[model samples]
Target: MKYMYWLLIFIPITLVARFGLQLNDGLVFLFCCFGIVPLAAVLGDSTEQISLYTGPKIGGFLNATMGNVPELLICGFAVQAGMYSLVLASLAGSILGNILLVMGMSIFIGGLKYKFLPFNKNITHNNFTLLGFAAFSIVVPFFFKYSGGGGITEHSLSNFSLALAVIMIVLYLLGLIFSLITHRDIFDDEDEDEDGEKEAPEWSFKKSLSVMIGATVCVAVMSEILVHTVEGAAEQFGLGEAFIGIILIPLLGNVAEHASAIMMAVKGKLNISIEIAVGSSMQIAMFVTPLMVILSALLGNTMEYVYTPMELLGIIISIVIAATVFMDHKVNWLEGAELIAAYIILGGAFLVFGIG
Candidate 1:
């Protein structure tokens, strides 16, 4: 992790190039891109350090929420920029990347060393149910838009999205209470420190909180610059903004969390790895997506929930595949390969066929 922090030097360089020298948007965009990754990792580590003091239940909630700060800020900035398509595509990409790319890598690499990986069946079941419902909620707007026979007004669609966003957020909060409070016993697994050696926190609570705050602020600055220059950057690369949002931005924002999941899996902690991947995806759908809908309105952009058919299809397929793979709460290398293959094929389709 210390080695990764060396990339932090790019943060200042990004600021200087963008604000001082006024470099090309493409170059500045790339610098901000690299800079945001290390900042996100720092934020994650700090969150982990703080978690050590909070106990598992509250700590788990903190990790789930803070873990997504990078992508949340990025998408928030994009929405503020009125790049609705890019933000929508990014939301879809995030769910796909987490469940498929990150989870697949974790399982595939871990499965090679272990015959079978098993996690908590109860937790997996609840997560998939929540994810499936969230997917269904988001797509309702898409169907509503198309099913209106060209008579649906943009204002009506926006109102309907706003209503659904409110309902999803309400349900998302209830879900937290359900799993973390009312039904926590069902979700909690037995403590497994058989060696009787608990890990210690390296940073003081004050230090962890301070560092998390600073890292988030820096990420926000970088995200703003990244979104500000996205168009120029896309034109320079000859790539559509939708493609960049779907593929590049999601990977860049959450790369740190992705690495953490894969590392946990390699250490034979499939339960933790799956939680990081699947839990984050659920938070994005239930929490972040709706939050963005409200933020878009506040930003005066009025972003709607309606997505392109391909984006909606990709999300639904990703969730379905994830649910199927984890149905039995056990996975092998072949299942991992299948998930990765699914992601690659989906990505290829987006590239070759275009998002719209």
Candidate 2:
């Protein structure tokens, strides 16, 4: 019955999309996101359970790789199809959306339901350490931006971008070292509810491992279709690739995460809710973007890391506000509202610029 339900729902959505590609490509592109992203999220989340159980570093690693499966798949296809800018902007947008929008909305709504929520502060702080470096990861790309270069194709540009990817990998490795070696205790779940300590869900670590590998496989399957559909949609809609990247793609990539955050909130697991929101975002930024670049390089395409001025501004503001709201040990309704509002402001700006 479960498999039947999934097949009935998801298969039609995908077929509607794949077939619709023959008629109206934009519609097909839209449905693919509406369809495929959720599927990948299911895969990614199942995989995440294994990662969480294996320990913090492994969990972080797993989430980092799989959290943005839809985005990664789309971007990889985009790269293969030669939509380099779209892939790059999508990476930037995914990070910002996951970190800022998903987390922000979850906090706001969850806090409104319950006045105060508790989370694993030590783990959050450890994640922040990675985020700090993630924010800094923007430096090199921005450096190349200020120089006279025409996005990825600019002379010596792809090399610089690739080099930056290498640097991010090294820094990420160091952060992992710091996370596991320097602060291993941060991952321990403290049973700390007033009524009594509740046991957390035990993840299917082996299942998650299998699914993680499976996600990589499915990604290869759908990417080609996604790339073709996106290009057709973009051309038909008269939308620029940049517009698609900075707005549509990221939001689509994160829909599953947004749903999970809300579900946790409804369940009254505020700490777990908040953890999913923030942890997922950190993974997107620190890990997903670099992986795309590496994969693009492997696929014989250049995934540039150029950010528009507004994109950079939005990212910086989102990270700062998100970090500030969560930095404290306590979370309240007001902070949640503020986070949501901040995201709204960013979203408004994106649609405005995206349509421009």
Candidate 3:
């Protein structure tokens, strides 16, 4: 009953958004962008519970899928509306959301509780390969655009993008198989059941998977509305579609992610903190964006993955600061504060509407 209350709340929002989209396309997108906050907040709390019982790989996969719930739904709806630019901005926003806004706020809030924490080094190592893939992926859109390739059409960028997506999706499947079956080392979370609040409930593979999917659906539906509402909200604030997405959409999504970071941070789980920040960024960059590309192609929409100069620099700076900070495998409250400051400065600069 209690869980159903959440489902109830979300379902209505989704419906309302659907109606809004029918009425005004701009408003629907606004609503979709706003959907991420509560979803993130809830998932951050629930994920720990699920992660403890189900173990990390499943948890990580769950997190990867659920963490992206908003993006997925918004993209789905956006594709139907032919708002390709909005979709693209949201993609870029998510990476920034995870790296700076989520990570920064998480550290600050978590530092208030505890100064530092420990986390898995091995997790950090594996994440690098994904991050590298993401970094490369981030650059691809730019290369395609200026490479004199008609900005995404000349090289049959769609064909190329689809092929690239095939490779990535294959990689995702291989990674999943490797973790869950072939070599289970990646998912074996030995430290899952920490914080002995309640007796750990046994989760069948079926139950965990079901809840994961259900939660994801709720997130997606809500997020689609969020995107819809964003259009209206942008009008209200007199903002650009890109500004709303690149700035606000990601920040709202960070609500859930920020909580995850803070929790890990307060536990002084710096490695997990960094991983959540960096890993989620990688997922957005490599996994989510590519998946969206493939979906766009199949849906008969042209989805381009180009990044603005601002986006490129943001990714580079975000990775450098984050990696440099986490390299020593330790964190202080001061360091956490520094990260938050950096984000503030960057965000302030980006807010200049005419600067672009």
Candidate 4:
């Protein structure tokens, strides 16, 4: 985790490349991508620190809201720029990356030490049930488009997206209530370790808030620069923005979660690792997607809920496979390998098929 802060060097490098030397867009894009990763890590860490000062319930809410701030900022900027496909692809990629790539790596690393990793079955089951519903919601607009047989108008799709976004936001809020309030015991049980050593924040509250705010502002600026370079970067690499979104952007935005989950798993805190993976995915599907939809609409560059058929199919299939993997409430290294293999195949498909 400390090593990630070394990436802070890229922040100055990106600025100098973009404005000082006026480097090529591809280089600027690459630098900004590296720059954002550590900023995101700092943002997440500071949020965790702040959560220590707040009580558990409020801390949970704070984590839930701040977990995806970097991704949301990037997508928000993309939405403003009318890069709808890029935003949508990034959202889908975040979901797949979390459930498959992050969780798979966590399980594989943890399973290497322990033959099997088990988590709270009932809690995991409930999380998956909500995840399944979220997946279904994501696919509905795609289904609506095709099922309409070319009769659906853009206006109607926008309207549908708006309405559905409202419903999703409501449901997501209800879910927060469910997990954090009425059933807090199930979700909050892992805050402490088996030996009952609950870690305390290392930074002062003022320092945490100041660092979080600073990181967020830096991420916002970097995201703007990053989005500005997407087209040139795509052209330079002979790739599509969708490919960049599907592969690169999510990785940049989620470096913190990816690192934290794997570290937790390695330490035999597999439950915390899975929670980070699955919970992050759920937040992307329910909270981030809907918030983006509504914000895009309000900003007059509306991003519909509709997705490319291939992209939608990949998300649904990933969710199903992930859910099935956890159904037995146990996982082994081989299962983790399978999940990683699936992600690789899907990524290759997105590359070959185009505009995922």
Candidate 5:
């Protein structure tokens, strides 16, 4: 966290690019992208600190809600700008990155020290069940779009998307109740040493609150600036918006969670590592995507849950691979390698095809 402070220099640089020097859109986009990383780190840290004062259940809720703030903010701005494709791509990218890039790296690094690591099978099953539900929700909308029997008007699609969004949100809430209340014990880390005392937070509650607010505001501002420049930047760099959304934006937004997952894995805390990766993906699918649908409508952009065939294919492949790897409750380095390889192949395909 201390080292992340150095990256704060990019904040001023981004501001200068935006208002002072009036740099090119591509350059401003680059600066804002880098600037958002450290702010995200601060946001995570502040959330953790604030959670210390709230108790486990509420704290877990807060952490889950704030985990993807940067991505959410960026997507919100993108929605406002009517970059519907980019928003949807970023949504898919976030889920894929967590399930593949983050989870795979954690398993691979953790496997380097241990030949085989086993986690809670019950939790794994629950996660995959939720993931399956999420996949179904997303797939239905695409089915609606393509199988409408004839031409589908924008109003009809928007209405269908809103209906699905409401259902998804309800399902997500049910999941929260199931996991956090009735089945809480299933997700608990059994390996945690009961006798080990917890350390006190360094920051006071007020300080944590202040930092969270400040970081969130800064992230929002940066995200707006970053999204506004995305089109110009994409054209300037000979890159497609899909490429930036699927690869770059997701990576930038989840950098903090990615680092934490890897660190937990390296420390042999594979349970926490798995939770962070899988849980983040579940959040994106269940909460963020649906919320974005509603938000986009309110913003007058009215994005549907429909996805291009390639994007849908990528998501389905990712879900299937993740389910297979974690189904046995055991993981090895080779399994991790397989996940990373799959992600790379999908990324390459997206890069080449520039899939909407």
Candidate 6:
């Protein structure tokens, strides 16, 4: 973990280039991209450390809330810049990336070591249902758009999206209540400990809180630099904004959490790994996406819930593949491989077609 901090060097380099010298946008973007990885890792680590003190329920809630700080910052900046399509693409990508890429890698690597791993079916199913509902919410606005309802105008669509966003947020809070309060034991892996003794936190609460705050601040600064350079970088690389948003942004924002999930799986804690991956996706869907909708409106960049056809299709396919894999309550390396393969294929299609 100490070695990961070395990536922080890019932070100063990015700052100096952006402020001290007029560096190439591509180079600034590249440096900021690498720089954010360790910051995100530190952020995730600090959050987990904090969770150790909070216990599983509240800890899980903290993880869900803070896990996507980078994404939120990036998209917030994008929204301010009027890159609404980019913002939506990043949201979609985060959801797909977690459920398919991160979860797949975790399960694949863990399955190789464990042969087969079982997770808590009740928790998994509940999360799966929420994921499906979230996906359906996205689909709803699109349905209204093409349904030929003569009364549906831009204002009406925006209103529809606003209402749905509020509802999703309400559902998200209800989910937290359900998992963290009413039925926490069913969803909590820590409850499996036979001794029922909570482990002592390695860090002092102040230290954990300080690190989480510091890492988050650094990520926010880096994300601003990154978002500023995105347009130039996209043009320089000949990659469409949609492709960059869908693949590159989410990958950078999520690399730290991705590493944590894979590590948990490698340690034979499949339940924890699943929770990290699926819970992150659930957060993106239920919390992050709706939050973006409300934020965009407040920022005067009012983005509707409607997604491009390809983006919608990509999300639905990813959800279906993930649901299929987890349905049996058991997972093997083959299933993991399948998920990764699906992601790769979808990525290739996006790269080739540049769908927004």
Q: State the TM-score for model 6.
A: 0.95
Q: What tens digits encode model 2's per-residue C-alpha lDDT throughout 1-356?
A: 02322532544566655765365677767656655665656664675466446643454445445656778778767776777667767776776676767776777777777777777777678667777777776765676668745654554666777787777777767766765677656655555334464335455667666766765665555555667877778888877666678767777667656766665665556555555566666666766677777777788766666666677777778778877987778777788778778767776776666632
lDDT by residue for model 1 (1-356), tens: 55679999999999999999999999999999889888878877887788679755455457656768878998998888788898888888888888899889989999998999877887777778889899889777888788877779998888888888889899899988998789988765564345455569999999999999998899889989999998999899887766888878888877666776777678777766777788888989998999999998777667889888888888999999988999887999899999899989988887776664
Candidates' TM-scores?
0.95, 0.81, 0.79, 0.93, 0.93, 0.95
lDDT of 5 by residue, 132-233 (tens): 998998898788778876788778889889888888889889988997889887677656546354548899999999998999999999999999899899
What is the lDDT, from 0 to 100, of the residue 122 in candidate 3?
A: 56
TM accuracy, model 1: 0.95
- The Cα RMSD in angstroms, rounded to one decimal, for candidate 6 relative to the true structure is 1.8
Clashing pairs in 4: none
Model 5: lowest-lDDT 10 consecutive positions: 55-64
Better of 1 and 2 by lDDT: 1
C-alpha lDDT of residue 264 in model 2: 60
Cα lDDT listed for each candidate = 0.83, 0.66, 0.64, 0.81, 0.83, 0.84
Query: CA lDDT of 347 in candidate 2?
Result: 67
Error of 5 at 38 (Å): 1.1
Q: Considering summed lDDT, which 10 consecutive residues are worst modelled in model 6?
A: 190-199
Per-residue lDDT of candidate 3, residues 1-356 (tens digit): 12323434545555665764364655544444444455565555566557667555555555545666666677678877777777777777777677767677766776677756445655665565666666776677567677764445544766777777777767766755765688666534345446444437456545655665675777776765665566676677777776766776667666655666666666655555665676677777777778878888888765766667776777677777766666666556666677777777767776775122
Candidate scoring better on TM-score of 1 and 5 = 1
Instruction: List RMSD in Å for every model shown.
Output: 1.7, 4.1, 4.3, 2.2, 2.0, 1.8
